[model samples]
Target: MDAMQMALPIVGIVAAAAVTFYAVSFAEIREKSFEDLEDKDFESGGFKPSFSSRQRRARRKADKEGRK
Candidate 1:
């Protein structure tokens, strides 16, 4: 019974901490405004191509050369 009393508080503290962590993690935050970006930034793709897209392009080029 003494051990149970000690363990109960420890478990409650851990559970409270986990709940707080998740609540903070998933809380809604404001989206950043893009007004600071220059025209050139928009002209280029806002983000870099993913690895899969780059690999697909390389494969297509290779297939075209193979056909030639």
Candidate 2:
């Protein structure tokens, strides 16, 4: 019984911390979702080709042209 009395507060504290963590996580996700929604105002919908991929494609195109 004495242990239970001491443990209840600890359990409550941990539960409250978990709830706060989840609430903040959810809020961040929601904020990011809204930010992405706003980002769709761009032409490509927030998609951009990586620099290395573009460089590789350009190199391949040049090689093909040189072979021709």
User: Estimated TM-score per prediction?
Assistant: 0.40, 0.59
The runs of at least 3 residues in candidate 2 whose Cα sits more than 4 Å from the true structure, single-residue gaps closed, are 42-68
Model 1 bad stretches (over 4 Å)? 28-68
Worst 10 residues of 2 by lDDT: 41-50
**Model 1 worst lDDT window (10 residues):** 28-37
Model 2: how far is 65 from its true place, Å?
A: 60
Best by lDDT: 2
Residue 58 of model 1 has an lDDT of 97
On the 0 to 100 scale, the lDDT of residue 19 in model 2 is 100
Cα lDDT tens digits, model 2, 1-68, are: 69999999999999999999999999999999988877775566565545698899999999999999
lDDT of each: 0.72, 0.89
In the range 23-68, model 1's lDDT, one tens digit per residue, is 7766632112333333236446774535698899999999999999
Residue pairs in candidate 2 whose N, alpha carbon or C atoms collide under 3 angstroms? none
